[model samples]
Target: MMLSLFDQFMSPTFLGVPLIVLALTLPWLLFPIPSNRWLNNRFLTLQTWFIYRFVRQLFLPMHRSGHKWAVLLTSLMLFLITLNMLGLLPYSFTPTTQLSLNLGLAAPLWLATVLIGVRGQLVYSLAHLVPEGTPTLLIPVLVIIETISLLIRPLALGVRLTANLTAGHLLIQLISTATFVLVTTMPLVSFFTATLLVLLTILEIAVAMIQAYVFVLLLSLYLQENV
Candidate 1:
């Protein structure tokens, strides 16, 4: 039986239980746990260096208070990158492609940052909705627009991640199918398409890592404003 292109996006089940749970949890186990030893192995050393640089750069713009989110945000970055990269493998599910999952991750964190802003600096938070020296006639309209923009942040985050991953996966699948079909009838053309597929796969790998970074980076920026 032939399957649809999007069938790959559907959640798989075993014994009537969703495998999405395993997809989400398994990536955590893939990461190497830090040990108590003073000296680290090469892989662990590289991992530590990369994470240190990432966190240092990520929180560079924020206040000291925002640094509190380092562990949460860094862990989230790793989780996302792992899921995205793993999803690119054969016969694997990409949970982040689901808007619901993405929104579930985005909304609470976005709201928490907003709440922190409101709690710590209520006047400043409200002031963000209306910039200084606004015309009296435009104040109400500007406030409304800003309010809508503020509320749309989480939705935007979710949609951006879903759209990017979905598009990349679809494009890769379409090209791969084309290459397979052409290989028998048009060897030369299929060769070129196969080469293109390889390049696209490489590009998709980069996209997976980058989209994960951009996701956490935006969250940090939002937190920066509030903190």
Candidate 2:
């Protein structure tokens, strides 16, 4: 397991700093504000809707200043997501497929839940975790359930993102390798397998976007519940 961490850095840097920086700075460097805005409007039409929704979120009601946080979070999501999807393009690495990487993203969400709720009220977040209308004798049981639920958030995030990306990539890699072997011996096998792998690669790209959308939307919902 420790060696896997080292292996992660062997081909690509484990933290995805290069990819992330590229995504972050690309908007400023290559495509400056006007051009970036035009591209966002043209390519990502629905993202504007999300920005509006994030602003006008009824349950949470983030302030104008707080809107920047949503932009930052959403930017991070799209950045990582684009990088993840790019991995399907041969000789690339999917950073989000890593548990350590996903966990890094999840840890801040966990802390945000704690910090936001704590700022509002020390026990405010616990309100949802606790049973107000339940039997008093079940308090310990309820507390345990709450603890488990809180702990599960990060675990769920890590597993959900990592599993989807890793499985999809592994399937492609495995099938492609087998296809090459078959082609060398039988010649007829590679044609269909290679075609299928290409189709599956496209599907994997869609799944990458879906996973990113799911993670971000879930976090938005969580933020709504807390704030």
Candidate 3:
């Protein structure tokens, strides 16, 4: 189905936002959260934590890059991920499932890859990508495949997130949409959305965790290839 850009009239100053950035900021800034954070279940790796902290430090200089942009961008990611898990509640939207939002998330990551990818000698970077010790004959073929795959990383990032989020939302949306229709006709079906919401909520939490892992892993992989 062709997804609609339902809110063409709205201006999202930060990213493909459903609401204004500052509007949501005060609450999170004011409220406290667990320091070890994931609205979803994930494998907690010290490696991932260090890498994330390192990347955040790397971006510190970019504070000149517009504070609003930084805050908005970061918050956009949080909102998406939070909402993805929010199906844990009945009738909440999955913002990431929406193309506008996923595109926003993917674009900056793609740009970051390109910027870093070309920072060093392109030829040297390309050479390192192939790794060490390969069959001489197979090396050329492997290089060709890796080159294509590397070029498509951004597209993969976008498609991966969009597909996963969309599939889950679509499934849950049907359940939700059905609940409303069924409720009018039958009392038994009235409780259906409730039960489905509970089950889907757990699944949604899993999806949220997986998507975050996929996003970060691919992001790290891109940087690893370049640096």
- Judged by TM-score, which candidate is best? 1
Candidate 1: list runs displaced more than 4 Å.
none
Clash count per candidate: 0, 0, 0
lDDT of 3 by residue, 1-227 (tens): 42543332233454655454443343355323335555423433553464467457534544333222444444444555555565345424344555565567777876775676577557767675576888888888989898787667677777788787666666766676688888878869769676986798678778886786567555655555555
Better model by TM-score: candidate 1 vs candidate 2: 1
RMSD of 1: 0.9
Candidate 2 at 143: error in angstroms?
A: 0.9
How big is the positional error of residue 26 in model 2, measured in Å on the Cα after superposition? 7.2
Q: After superposition, how far is residue 143 of candidate 3 from its true place, in Å?
A: 4.5
With a 3 Å backbone cut-off (N, CA, C), the pairs that clash in candidate 2 are none
**Global lDDT of each model?**
0.95, 0.69, 0.59
Model 2 residue 219 lDDT?
71
> Could you tell me the TM-score of candidate 1?
0.98
lDDT tens digits, residues 99-150, model 1? 9999999999999999999999999899999999999999999999999999
Can you give the TM-score per candidate against the true fold? 0.98, 0.74, 0.56
Give the C-alpha miss distance for residue 49 in model 2, angstroms.
7.1
